[model samples]
Target: MGGGVLGTMHAWQAVLRGHEVIHLEREPEARGASVRNFGLVWVSGRADGEELETALRARELWAGLGERVPGLGFRANGSLTVLRTEAELAVAEVFAAGPDAAARGTRLVDPAEARTVNPALRGAFLGALWCERDAAVEPRVAQPALRAHLAATGRYTWLPGREVREVDARGVRDDHGDHHHADVVLLCTGAALSGLVREIAGPVPVRRVRLQMMQTEPLDEPLTTSVADGDSLRYYPAYRGVELDALNANQPQPAVAAEHAMQLLMVQRADGGLTVGDTHGYDEPFPFDVVEEPYQHLRQVAEAILGRPLPPVRRRWAGVYAQCRDTGQVVHRQRVADNAWLVTGPGGRGMTCSPAIAERTVEEIGL
Candidate 1:
């Protein structure tokens, strides 16, 4: 049982199927990766095939949900992975000419065209890889908004502050010593993979990923579209190819950037502040804190792109998300019992693919 985006989306799907759902969460409110993200329905760099398909479907779902729940703040703003160097441009050119370009709504735009798409990018740039399929929603508010929509149907009950301690074929028992009966139990837990998850399915194949993220005060102007620096070409899978390999060989990140696995993904919030991030930390025993080096690097890159200094930093934080070790599996879904299942390890795709992931889980389980 969980109450994050994946779990909330599961509840939404079940209620849509005429099932009375009782969603449970350990915390009174979600204080995890779900809220601590860029709120990006990012489709620009998803690995092709299943991952990309799931993201496209989820983007559609989020758009539809936005119509029903205004608080979702869903927007088809798309994204511009700004490319400054010739190497980054080369990778984007290859991707723009790829077979999946049309499917991903991808295009390579010149500097003039890119500026038209997002005028806030006043800084110099070679070009940009634009993906019109990309979208965004307010991560901090999405779950509560979705839950409110589910509640409107009178088929959903949100039970936060109740951690499931036991699971069986019939139902689950909460930490408060209360048992709730159900026909089937879908454990959509996020990164808390120990305790009940371990008891039910043992150790999972997924690994916990930690990342550092931050938000700015407020930009005087609108960002218009989500933005990414050239470093993204190295991190996202869609750009993987010989061209990328050459680029990587010829242009490696600086020491601090390379050390932290850093990338610049900036999205403007509804309030005008920009949400920027992120550095990947895969090793276990992740630091329980944020470091200044990555943030400094991010600031330098972001300012270089915008040709202006960013507003004062208002918030800085670290979040941990579960990602499948076997990069091939979109998500790890395990049958823990006769009528119980465990689902998690969506990785960064959690926000972008949650709606579609939950939909697939329902179909597979015949829910």
Candidate 2:
């Protein structure tokens, strides 16, 4: 039973259902992709059908939960995928014209309208694709806030710095040789795929993805909505249209961006700083050091979009998360034992869909 967003969500689901919960974490707090992310409850770019449905439901649940837990700092800020070139705008138009575009709350806006939506976006973009369903929260405080709420219920116990070494159908034992019993056991480990996780899910069809990101000092202006560049079209599945194919064929990403598999996703934090990212690395044996080239490219692209210099760099880091290699599966979930379940490999969808995933798990187990 991990204590990342996924694990916390599972615990929240059970506690909401009136089940006494015992949450365990290996570290003093979650220091994984959950907190390293943009704290984005992104709904528009999810793959269609089941994935999209899950994202939508999760978005709704997040809003409701945010109200209950005020410290989440949830805001329905929406998002803008700004298009700089005619080719990128063409792809956005095609995506906007799709059958489910309206259902996804997607619309194409002219440059003027894009600026109107987010004044901080002073760059001269051709246009932008807007997704009103997108939202954000304070990732740095989300876990502790949720835990505080759960603790108030007098039915939740948080055991931090406890690494689960052994798990059985009945319960689990931590590294300190302590055994805890529970009627049901759920393992929501984010990216740690060793020991019990490996023993149960042998040679899992999951791979790790590494990414680098950086945050800036407080900005002079506010980024009302999260932002993404045209390069994001290659990363998100929702843009897999004929126009996207043409755009990809005709206009490729810049050398440095392509080499690092980079995308520009920027969001403003509660402190008025901006969280910007990121580049993807999927090969095994990820580099021990974060490369500077990706960060340089990101800063250059971000400055161009803002039409101003970025704030001084405040923090830089890298995060890795498990992703299902099989594209068909939303996440790798399996019943590893009689009363034990392993739910991991949500990839980047973890932050966006964890709430709904946990809700489904509770229903499936009749908790």
Candidate 3:
């Protein structure tokens, strides 16, 4: 059991089914990847088949949930992956013309057209891949907001500052020496795969991914929509093809970008500050510190796209999220016991796909 978005979403699902729910969290509040994310209900980069379908379904669920919970700060602002080079545009062209492009709300637009969709992008670019299905929410507050809504149903109990130390077919025992019995138990632990998780479900297929991000002071203008640099083409899956391969070979990312596996994905907050990031790292024993080179590269790419200076960066941080090493798997859900299930490893899709993941979990578990 955890207090991140995954845990909260599972709680929401059970409450929706009119079940009495007791939610246990290790922290007083969620402070993991769930809160430390871009708050994106991203659907543009999901791989085809199950992954894409899950993201689309989650997008629909998020829209409805956003309406119910105002603090979710959900916006159908869509996204524009700005392309500055012919190579990047080629990838977008292939993707936009692909069979599922229509389903993904994807389109290739000229610079003028892209600017019309998001006027803050005064910087020069060849074109952009517009994804109308992409959306945003305020990540930091989403969990608590959803929990509050669930509490109103009079069947939800939130017990934070308590960690579940043991689980069996009957129930769980917390670190406080208290025993809480239940008919079913779901562990939505985020990235903590040791101790209880390992003891109960040894050697899971998940790995941790570290990423760095920053939030700047409010910009004078609105971002209108989330924005991405062409480097994102190399990161997202839908762009894979002969054209993408050629683009990768012909126009490799800059030295700093390649070294960090960096991508520039920026979204505006309710207060107008821009959330910018991120670089990928998978090696174990992750650095306990944040590096400056990646931040410098992110600022450079973001400013280049906006044609203006970013507001002063007020904060910077790093987050580690669990991911399935298989890359194509949406999430890792396993029944560790007759009545207990262990679910984790959503990666970057945690925020985008948690709602649907929880829905599917409850359905499969017959909750």
In order of listing, the candidates' clash counts read 0, 0, 0
lDDT computed for candidate 1 = 0.93
Please give, for residues 291-317, the per-residue lDDT of candidate 3 as tens digits.
Answer: 899999999999999999999999999
RMSD of 1: 0.7
Which stretch of 10 consecutive residues in model 3 shows the poorest summed lDDT? 161-170
Against the true structure, candidate 1 reaches a TM-score of: 0.99
lDDT of 1 by residue, 301-338 (tens): 99999999999999999999999999767899999999
* TM-score against native, each model: 0.99, 0.99, 0.99
Q: Write the per-residue lDDT of candidate 2 for residues 287-346, one digit (tens) a residue.
A: 999989899999999999999999999999999998999865678888888888899999
TM-score of 2: 0.99
Global lDDT scores for all candidate models: 0.93, 0.91, 0.93
Q: Which ten residues in a row have the lowest lDDT in candidate 1?
A: 284-293
Scored against the true structure, residue 255 in model 1 reaches a CA lDDT of 92
